[model samples]
Target: MASTDNALKTASVLAFERKLDPSDGLFHAGNWDGRDDTTAWKPVTLREKSVRGTISNRLKTKDQDPAKLDAAIENPNLQTVDVATLPADADTLRVGFTLRILGGTGRPSACNNAAYQTKLLSTVQGYVDANGFGELGRRYAHNLANARFLWRNRIGAEQVEVRIQHLEKGQPKTSWTFDALQLSLRDFQTPNGVEKDINSLADVITTGLAGKGHVLLQVTAFARIGAGQEVYPSQELILDKATSKKSKTLYDVQGIAGIHSQKLGNALRTIDTWHSEADTLGPIAVEPYGSVTTLGKACRKPTDKLDFYNLLDGWLLKDKAPPPDQQHFVMAILVRGGVFGEAGKD
Candidate 1:
């Protein structure tokens, strides 16, 4: 029975806390053979360098004349940028970080309407009771095993290996190693050779999400890109365009080049094949609006009623549930967590 005060009314204040948390990945350099003993690896550091770049962008109509273009190329653009590369003696890059899988999915951090909140939790519980988080867990585990979080660093590597360690009280309970290149980034398919390891890792993550206290994991990935190859680190977004002299600023933590936790989270949640364009566009990071910033357009629009808010409201208020895939998408948004309260108008 719906409460009289809250029946058919959306909560004005609702929010869920993110469940999967990861620390910033720190970069280190070492010989590929020395990967077994990462204790001897050296911290990768950032250096500021100046490079002369030719003006190659399309010129304005007035400046397109041959004489004008030739003169422009002579005065090359000098760019001061930050760069990180493996030391001459090191042929591999080591990135390491810790991940914490939290519980209490679908439980809002804040909600004023108890009735609405109760229904939401019930809905989430129903999904867990039925699905067991296997699909979601498998995709996340796939991302980790494939080293997708390495982004550009994983590209063009001669070889890549990823190691995941389940931690208990600062000690490893179990560990798994992956030959990352064999795993495809375009899909979450666990190859026959590595299915056992992938499933084991997924089981741990799904268990944590099922409210089994919490789970901690230590992750390390090695990319053998050859000695002195330039490594890519997360670039800091500069808001003050005029004040900064450098066009690019690489992220660092206390002088150690690193990747942001947000970036890692994005990579982990790239499991949304349920979107409308799954036929063409492939997976994107789970989002309420199905937004891919790089594409500059939304895939799950309200017009289609496939977005988070529409599906959630219909499911909760109208007794209308979305399709199975959409139901999974809704649950993923709840797992990602955000302020989803409806706004009031005067």
Candidate 2:
């Protein structure tokens, strides 16, 4: 029989997701692409078009005027494409990623058993580091792991969060297994650099956007099945939400409709409704290549009592539903006049 706790088995599966499109491509995105001519690093920029591709054509100066020779020689240097100078509309791109751990060969452990688990995690890190993951970049150790042991590196575009947990309850005498492993990159760092934490990655995104006034997201998903059929990718999703909540809130409070709190409030309310309905009416089949359509309230503020007009307080994850608490889950809060956007709203 499947225990009530059987669902928790899947909890151990970690899923990480992020958006991976920077408004520009020529500059730094998330992690370094290891492609720069100056430092064995060439920035990973999504190339939509190119004027030249062949070396034979590149050296074809046969019909040039002598006066134009110097200019043409310099033309190769001038042939560079400046992604930074691209139009603002170019920021519209996003990506998605997913990683999962099917059951391990051995038994598993409890989530609270931090001591022994740490050592086991280190062993895994050493394995990954010794055996590089190619373009997936290097593995990094996380907090629960020995803070330095290292897990694999990945990039995601948007519309997701990273989750990790134990595959089961009792301490396993031999081994442990994970169910899901996924990450969502908030910005395009490098398609191949390591980010130790979600916070650090988020910081990179917020900083880049603040300076460039735009951002892009790219997502990649690695799926492994059987022996060979194990890699696939998805189209990018662009985040068009211009202007930070901070800037918009300021103008909004000042009667500037563009930055109005009412709009923010409305957005939150919408999120709340949509989320609530999905939870109640779902087993929403949110699978790959499947439409992720849902109707729910936006991010909202919960009230003292159950007020229909007020914002929703939180959400309920089928996996994280409480035990004896009997209370509804609270997702996020909307401050009456709280900090809307300093950074990391997600």
RMSD in angstroms, all models? 2.5, 22.6
Give the 10-residue window scoring lowest on summed lDDT in candidate 2. Answer: 141-150
Off by over 4 Å in 2: 1-41, 46-275, 278-331, 334-346
Instruction: Report every candidate's CA lDDT.
Output: 0.91, 0.23
Candidate 1 Cα outliers beyond 4 Å, as residue runs? 1-6, 59-74
Worst 10 residues of 1 by lDDT: 1-10
For residue 264, give model 2's deviation from the true position in Å. 18
* Backbone steric clashes in candidate 1, count: 0
Best by TM-score: 1
- lDDT digits (tens) for residues 1-346 of candidate 1: 3567546677999999998899999999998898888587999999999999988777675747888777977788889999999999999999999999988888999999998888887888888888878888888899999999999999999999999999999999989999999998887777889999999999999988888856999999999999999999999999997999998999999999999999999998999999989878888999999999999989989999888999999899988878888888888888788899999899
TM-score of each: 0.94, 0.19
